[model samples]
Target: MSGEERGKRAARNEDLFRQVNERLHDLAVISGSSEPHGKFVCECEQTSCSLLVELSAGEYGAVRANDTRFLVFPEPWHTSPEVEAVVERHDRYWVVEKRGTAGAEAEDLAERGSNLL
Candidate 1:
């Protein structure tokens, strides 16, 4: 696939993962789970990735503060340098901000209400 196509695909995959995490958060709220941390799937470009990262609600909220930002594992393989940059790094997870075409795509998805909680 072309570079732009690859970026778009990555954005879509990450957005989907973000949606899942949003649902998980909503469930936590509904269930009144006072747990300090939640398990969220890694928002990486790799389709086969099933790595889960644990984060506090505040930490996840920080990552979701930006439409183009995503939560991923801190490992290097979890990041796509071609389409994103690591904006924040924590002990358990890294926040990646999509750039260029991928960023536009992520913003578009967010605007479409895909992140509704």
Candidate 2:
């Protein structure tokens, strides 16, 4: 491709990144809500690629998988290489961001226990 075309592509990618951030904030509002009537975390981006996502704003949060809660997730998310990859996947078309507490934290508070992780 020509240099000019590449530059435009990069600019477009940057805009998508901003959109992802905005979508994350919107999803946070829904995910952080007290009720679970409808889904709040919808995939924000849809691509011709296999992984299609919807950016939603309301639903139950994922605090654990299987029987585990309180996962030791890398902090800041931005500095985590794997996480950054998820966010930059599809050549910047798919960006993943997280907000709010994990499931284990909620469960712990309910039981009046400390979050082990």
Q: Could you give candidate 1's per-residue lDDT for residues 6-68 as a string of tens digits? A: 988899888889999998888987898888998899999999999999999888898899999
Estimate TM-scores for all models.
0.94, 0.26
lDDT of 2 by residue, 1-117 (tens): 664444333333323433343455556575675432322222222122123233223211332121112111122332222211232333212333322222232333434532222
Residue 28, model 1: lDDT of 84
Which RMSD values do the candidates have, in order? Answer: 1.9, 15.1
Best by TM-score: 1
Q: How many backbone clashes does candidate 2 have?
A: 15
Model 2, stretches more than 4 Å misplaced?
Answer: 33-47, 50-117
> Deviation in angstroms for 105 in model 2?
40
lDDT of each: 0.91, 0.31
* Model 2 lDDT, residue 78, Cα: 26
Model 2 vs. true fold: TM: 0.26
Candidate 1 lowest-lDDT run of ten: 108-117
